[model samples]
Target chain A: MKNLWFHLMPYKDLPDDFREEHPSVWVDIDSGLLDAERVHQHYHEYLDELEFAGEVGFDGVCCNEHHQNGYGLMPSPNLIAATLTRRTSAPAICVMGNSLALYNPPTRVAEEFAMLDCMSGGRLIAGFPVGTPMDTIFAYGQNPSKLRDRYYEAHDIVMRAWQEPETFAFNGRYNQLRYVNVWPRPVQKPHPPVWIPGGGSVETWRWCAEMDYVYSYLSYFGYKAGAATMQGFWDEMDRLGKDRNPYRAGFLQFVAVGETEKEALELYREPAEYFYGRCLHVNPKWASPAGYQSEATIRAKVQSQVALAAAQSRAGNGQNGGGRPGPMGAARDWEQILDLGYVIAGDPDQVAERIRQVCIDLNVGHLMLLCQFGNMSTELAKYNTRLYAERVLPQIQDLFDDRWEDSWWPQPLEQPATARALA
Target chain B: MRETTISVGGHPVRVLTGGDNPSAPPAVFFAGIGGVPTWVPFLDRLAESRRVIVPSLPGFPGAADFRHLDTLLDWVVHCVETVEALDEAPVDLIGSSAGGALAAEVAAIAGSLVNRLVLIAPFGSHDTEDPGADIWAQVPGPDSIPNLVCERPEAWKHAWQVPEGAEAIDYQVMHTRAMEAAARYLFPFGDTGVVSRLHRVDHPTLLLRGSEDRVLPTSSNERFCAALAGPVRTGELEGAGHLPELDTPDDLAREINAFLADQELG
Candidate 1:
């Protein structure tokens, strides 16, 4: 129903042999590979593309946090979100959010999010993510065992800091604050609608359901691979006797549209290959650190499709022959990528049909479309965004809106003539 | 071998006790990163002369949770309390790898409870120049066992192998939990700032390391030797890895026993 534009802002110029030459795309990725001039140019171009998404017609624009990662350039997505707030008017600035555990005194996040909300005139969708093992545990050096504990405590502190009018003393296992009073309160009463971007953690689903927050599954693998995780989330909601309002869930998908299916596929092939092959060239060792995943989630993962594929790969090789390359590791041609539904590439009608089917199948209400991905030039990104905005978005925008109210969406105040004049 | 539970800090810790001589002061053995889930042969050899008490540090096999211990200081206090709760004051203390660092801390803080201290490849002091291999960075399961816990990973498979009747995934979870517990204290940099406090320990101490330890550098042993205020002796075992207890248990046990007896180690 709500088509939001998402950007990974990946470094587009990684050499063709990056996968072979580089140990990983994150954490310890060699600093020599990055070009300062190119990165500066890329940042300006990416920001322009995000603003263009707003001007052309996206309901929201999204950015997320990742540290020491080549694929995700934004270590501090708040800075990007802050810029977007001043530049874009109509679109919600969705910062799919800060890794809570990394902040020393997490009230820093509380203060920054409040500032963004005020800057955006209340058009802010606050995202709280229990960041990736690469970001939180490896890059930030958070104790994996205590990461979740620290995140939960930080969440409580941030929420209390935002909602509590009076100054308070907070004591937690991970953090102890003497006087907790956040300045410059957010324009949204009680706080902006909270969205939790998670990577198939079972505890995250249960927590989202219990807290009545939107569970946004930000999967790089497309909807076909993401269906199970989304389904798992809905099932948990069902078990908890919560309504399947659909607005409670969000799904991210890589989409590129053109005049014809063949045209779209040909247009996106280079970027798709670059994104999947090089951007996702993470070392298997860094994939899952100890205690980064909960035991229950690990159990679920063992029975998942990815695990089955790994088992088959191991069987094909000798018993002691090293681990199976992850889902993103194997070399995939364009057809395999399309067949596996890693990206939805087609004409407007075809793209709309596939997206609608995916939303209905997964019961997803917020469709976070990653129109700009790895190595896509500014011209190509705008072309993809404009084409989708002109044709595909209209067909899918009203699918769930009439049936359900999106409580998770931000309710921004109507802009005054004076504010527009100042801009 | 006898199995019992001792309540330390109100949490029941699983302890393994064995040896021929009960009249002598008990020898408390704190396990390394590869926790003692079952009876290890190295403990058996050490138990031959004196009573050996091996407590499954929290989040390891018998002790199932380390969440209650908030900080490294809390872990140290818990270790000291476990040692004190044994009703054997001034006992000979031996720790291996991660446990070695912990044992050194206990000896530094509670000198009265530890008569003699033995640290096998201890991890309390860190030298930035010779910072060892990143153990936490290694992939979990069979692939990393050689780099982390043992020299002969094939032979020491039992250290992390899935038990009969237990699901493979559960074994993975257990192994990960143990590693997580270890990471809680020694993450990022394996230093706990114990090097500065080592001057407090006045007891006779012995430091041992495996010649082939890939997880810790030889500089760590030197760091401990330089910082320790007590009478210190250092030895290295040939053909042993980070966890010499599982690599060359006979040689490791002989070294520990000799150290506790105040005799020259062969």
Candidate 2:
């Protein structure tokens, strides 16, 4: 398994009464709640922590884009990735990525990704995400119904701009460019490997399969809730007559490993609670705008809810994620999170065991370890990264590498230790 | 009323027409939130004297997805093509809620086809200050309309009468389908650049608001009134909410008739 350290530079100083005072953590997160000075402090701290991941032997260091969100402070992952490129010599500088649809002429993505690749010496894994409805639809004001269309068009333009030999004029419904040429062409042949991070959209599954690109499930709920989506993706790959190469898939899991299980449980409880409870308190409306989700997905969601409701009634679970929030949403405690497998919390042995199970079961070659989550102190995050790198990485790093060659990973990921030494 | 399909830019559009007389001026009614069913006795009442064309804008009920429309301006082109196909004089247009936003766009660009435009709680743009509550964000299941759409609980019976053995999930699919169109045109805030182009709407227009419409409070419409250059009048439907035609159809019809009559004779 290719273990990569993921950073979601979240605001750490939300008041204790945030759930009661603020209605949401995304889109409409109250500006009054943010302390600019503290954010400045957190930025430097988070960057230092991200830099530490490389020193601690993480195969890669990743950053992602989010807008108007308290949890994800990087609206422009490219900028952060650029900063990391200079400070760190991690095997891969994964920018998991710029929301492709948001940029007017998506050639911007091509140009930037090329710059990052060149700067990082061909060590950039490009992540093209349709983005969360809150980020793309609500925050940036893209039409949800047309978001995917824009995303596909943007993806096409970015690819052509990177790979095409000559300058080309592209005419698309959403984008029209008189001159389509990208300068500072990527260091990698053709372009850096593209990793599409999807949030359980079947359309994404089909697109990724057709393109033969990596279809990464950037799930918050870990393997338990994410199993269906992962299975669905592999099932899609099967339908498309594609091989079940684990390298074609990736999964993001929050992990908290310490010297002992009790140490992990005690150390991570507050941050985990802060992350899951306060960071995910998004308004239902903001989370899912009309047309953001496909019609089939909508129907499937409703049917699943109905099925879940029936199952709940049969078992008297009385859990509704919406409205009453009986046993779901931001109100969930750390124990609940552990029970649901949202986080893998234990000693290195236990953490390695659970993550290995995730790799084997989900058939994911890339395991994105979310070591730095909501409000984790820079000290704690660095320690978590170091612990995982030292104790757990040896256990699971070879899970699928012997069987499958991961084309989606940066070239350095092939010989990360050598790459690090040379750098 | 007769339901028919008309080609708008090669995409077959679902349309319902009634009172189609050769000489009578056309009065096209655009369904507010969902589709043709949302507008009840008001649509029938308008069709009594003139041709009332209610096309299920793509992704609403019988219509296909609105993805073909491309941009918000494409919707205006679709509306223009729709009006040109009417084969009648400038029609009086009535649009409610989400439909009102589209109708407003049509009136701003294709004012030649409109004698009078009536917008009922239209949402076409976003405003940072008074970002109205999103109806889709709330829980109603696909099978039923939210109570906020109606001022009185009993008012819902006039429109959303659930059929026997009807699946709530089906309605949920329809609800999402309708929302896809609306969110495409007007997301977060309902403000399209119509405010800048309001001068193009040379016809008399009436902006009607529901007294209890929390979804789109009337206070947020100040910019719209200021932007409108023609005899842009504002009125309130006494006890209605966002979807007046669903409940106060008679009252809505009376207001529409009063406005159209005065605009016609004057």
Candidate 3:
């Protein structure tokens, strides 16, 4: 339960008042604002926090891959992970990795991840996500219909490559392997722990539940949008009769804390706006292509948008939503975002309590917090990171310790010969 | 861990690197023409402690094939950028055979990014006195080795084979096509022109050659050392062919270990 993961990003730097006037995502700004020097400095700052996070007792720090987007600013998370291994000790190196299907053969992922695991002394947690349709279909030129199958096949090949002791043969629809073996197998026995990050899709949730892998809901659309999806996941676990284990689930949230709520809000306003407005400005072609998303998921997105509109209408009254922040109160106005307590922006005490309340409300076992969002300065991000590490993390360290008794929920399993066999 | 893949100029390239060691600078090893990463032995040795990366060229064994890559400079820039992205910045480069050509171009263009370079039997140009590259196919024999310094002509007689052009390897057909591609783009020998630019390279460089290399003469390696602007060092592995890492791994490893020992991991 003390495993607090931080998503540190180099936000597009802007003036303090940028957010007050513009209610958009921080990444929407032009690329001219960022230079190699700024990028270099920002990288060191984030690394400092990762080291600080471990020193403060968090089990790991998290970095992810995104390309041609401003929201996260990390086109190559492995680069960040490589640097992290030298900068920090004690924390596991977690990369919510390169999209499997987007890669050819996928054994490259196996090889690199194995290398990271070895270099880190077996403290590597590998993540596989059925990549976003936009990046998959448009950017990588994968077919939407075949995306799922390719992703699954890539995952299968990677796993086999990892577990196989010697060369074996594998011939699949997408990949053919006459000899299947990767040098430098992961240091962890039968490979390190595998976590599947999800975007609240039915297929992902069901698959994670069935496979008994950790389901990290990278909460971007907020808690409300995720409510039904998580319910479906838990319900599947119930039907499968798998005893509930908190380790099997995790969630991500954007967090910002200051000495006072006013100061925090003032600091967060501009960058938060940039994150929502500029960075996330998705071309409809990329974000929601025709036939890209399933009908059910598309409907959910539309419904979420409607809810956002209604909330914004209510917030226009200029009064908080009956003590709860209205759509505009704390929503940050992300596109179609259902602000269900995913974000915490306030003073240390207030934000800490908010985080605790959200964790309890969501029953989320793992909390991967994003301390740096949008174009927040490196110094400010470090301040938030230190404050959380020193002040807030201690408050909720025991929220889920000994919370589950399901010893069989998802214990490490010896690799079966079939799965380990060459492709 | 799964293999990491990225695209360069619409070509899918796979990169496999050693562990996360920020203090340790990254090193890139290029695949042989028509070759993938799994072909070499030194790949493992290079990845031992340093951050090492290798990319699959698009038209290799199983990748989407490109007709020919005319300019070695473009390929070099692509490789440098790919390596930079992997290490979050610049890195050292290692190349063998034709890959050595690409490595030299990368060092010339993105000179600042390369901390050091180790080129093995690099193929670009020889002096006017040396026989020009045969457009047909290359024949493999003792003489195919690039850095043979044996004074006894009879000793190298058995090692040298009759001149044969592109028909030497299974990838000869692809090399023929690549030659056509180069013909289309007028393959630039600018890397040779920029030999003096090697002095501009702030990082130290070590050139490794086989003692009995026939493809590239020992003089070429010596000229490479003299032309390099950076601190330059040269070494020859005895009883080695062009591919010494494959024929004599221990001697090659010892030479590399000796060179790397002098530099900081940073």
At residue A188, what lDDT does model 1 achieve?
A: 92
Per-model B-chain TM-score: 0.94, 0.88, 0.71
Candidate 1 lDDT, A1-423, residue by residue in tens: 788999889998899999888888989999999999999999999999999999999999999999999999999999999888878888999999988999989999999999999988898999999998889888998988899999999999999999998999998888989999999888898899999998777788889988989999887778777876787888888899989998999888999888998899889999988988888888767777777887787777767645667766867853311222353454456777787687999999999999999999999999899999889889999999999999988888889877898888898888612245336
Pitting candidate 1 against candidate 2, the one with the higher DockQ is: 1
Clashing pairs in 2: B124-B190, B125-B189, B125-B190, B125-B191, B126-B189, B126-B190, B126-B191, B142-B171, B142-B172
lDDT of 3: 0.61
lDDT of 2 by residue, A1-423 (tens): 688889999999888888888888888889998899998999899899888888888888889999999899999999999887778776588899889999978999999999988878789999999998778877887877788889989999999999999889999988899899899999888678889998666788888888878888887887777787788789888998999999899899999999999999999999999988888877665666677788888777767677878978887878643211211253458888888788898999999998899899999998888998877888899889989999999998888777788878776433322234345
lDDT score of residue A349 within candidate 3: 89
Which CAPRI level is candidate 2? medium
Model 2 residue runs over 4 Å out of place are A310-331, A412-423, B18-26, B47-51, B102-112, B115-117, B122-145, B153-158, B161-167, B195-207, B217-234, B258-264
Error of 1 at A403 (Å): 1.5
lDDT of each: 0.86, 0.80, 0.61
lDDT tens per residue, model 1, B1-266: 99999888889899899987778569999998858778888989999888999888988778887888878899999998988888887889999998998999999899999888999999887877888888778765466756566787754676666678877776667777887888888887789999999999878898999999988999999989998898899999999999999999999999888778765522
Worst 10 residues of 2 chain B by lDDT: B136-145
| Candidate 2 displacement at residue B234 in angstroms | 4.9
Question: Of models 1 and 2, which has the larger lDDT?
Answer: 1
Could you estimate the TM-score for every candidate? 0.95, 0.90, 0.53
